[model samples]
Target: MESSSDTFGKDDSADAKLQESRVVTEEEWLQKWETNNIGFHNEQGHPLLKKYMDIFLDGRSGLKIFFPLCGKTIEMKWLADMGHQVVGVEISESALKDFFTEQKLSFSEEPIPGIPGKLLKSTTGNISLYCCSIFDFTSTITGKFDAIWDRGSLVAVNPCDRERLVTIAEIYALLMLRATLRPPFYVPDSEVKRLFGKSCDITCLEKVDGLAERPKKWGLDYFWEVLYMLVLK
Candidate 1:
């Protein structure tokens, strides 16, 4: 059931996104952190992440939540603070450091015995951030999760990598994913159905007229923040 504009939910232009075929490299992301060129970086995180917190919890406790391409997101800290374990993967190691340091969470880093990357564990042991590419990550590495919080990961991801992204969030890994679609990475509702419908049941939770509110941000004529709940079928 879809609701209107009060719904909680773009820097890349439609044409630019459409024309760009090369997948964004991990080095580029590292550079974004190094240069502080991350315009999309938000210390506060997505507002809907907090508003929809209950939905993510879904009457559960001690949920192991996953975040793909998590770049120092505040949501992880918030969940960890709430006593849920957070498993996140990102390519930039510095971003992981920033997350722990900025959040004032004490953490220890160690190399994965059989892998090329390292893992940072919060001293309290509720949060684990993987300093590696999302593509190399699996349930085997992070273990299973109860939920997935996908805010910017989908849109920031190249079209080619989407299949892998969706596969990683399969039912075997999590109970559900709250796919919050945002502008600059405008993926329409129809496309969403085509992508997730085969494996998961799709539901539209809310739709907000985001373009009307921030008409100048996306450089586009129209934009809507739509939320989709994808549950394993």
Candidate 2:
């Protein structure tokens, strides 16, 4: 893995300008959806996910995996095929509907108590998509996910809101604090403790490589990127 500083050294100025921009909100993201501007959605499972599924799953079955900013990706199908349950969160109902329609999967929707949105559950254990906001998610709705796979959620937000997203991520970690796995790098333990209100034993923390893949929409700087994974304990 390359040094974070080295990666940002020459691009610091460009990054600074980018950071000064406002983070996109649910409404803004929805606007993107209305215009069919979702270029980030992948037609297949993430390469890194396919490569490390064995290492992450480790023969475990019936595990629950969380997908934030799911964006109609078929990764959930891959996880479900492995005998794991998938809880996906997305802010755009349009995208979620497209996912179901495209997959030819019929689902029933139910209201999420105390939450503004509803849950969409497929008949099969293969996938469950939540049409809700990420910040408003709780264990009551999502239950506890065994492993969290954040392919694009963390880096999707503008730099200003990245910290807030991290805090939310820590809360998610705390919810599954007793899970069999923990997060690798990118998410700090201190932040996890702050959000979880307790210390977490993070087993199998490793910075694996080869996560960089993007469509033509992403700039050159983001063409090659690193992604982190965790198995909570």
Best by TM-score: 1
lDDT of candidate 2 over 19-112, digit per residue (tens): 4465566687898889987666667656666766676676778887787878887877777766788888988888888888887888888887
Stretch of 10 with least lDDT, candidate 2: 177-186
Q: Candidate 2, clashing residue pairs?
A: 181-231, 181-232, 182-230, 182-231, 182-232, 183-230, 184-229
Worst ten in a row by lDDT for model 1: 3-12
In candidate 1, residue 177 scores what lDDT?
50
Per-structure clash totals for the candidates: 2, 7
* Reference-based TM-score of each model: 0.85, 0.74
Clashing pairs in 1: 10-183, 10-184
TM-score of 2: 0.74
lDDT of 2: 0.61
Segments in model 1 whose C-alpha atoms lie over 4 Å from true places = 3-22, 180-184, 211-223
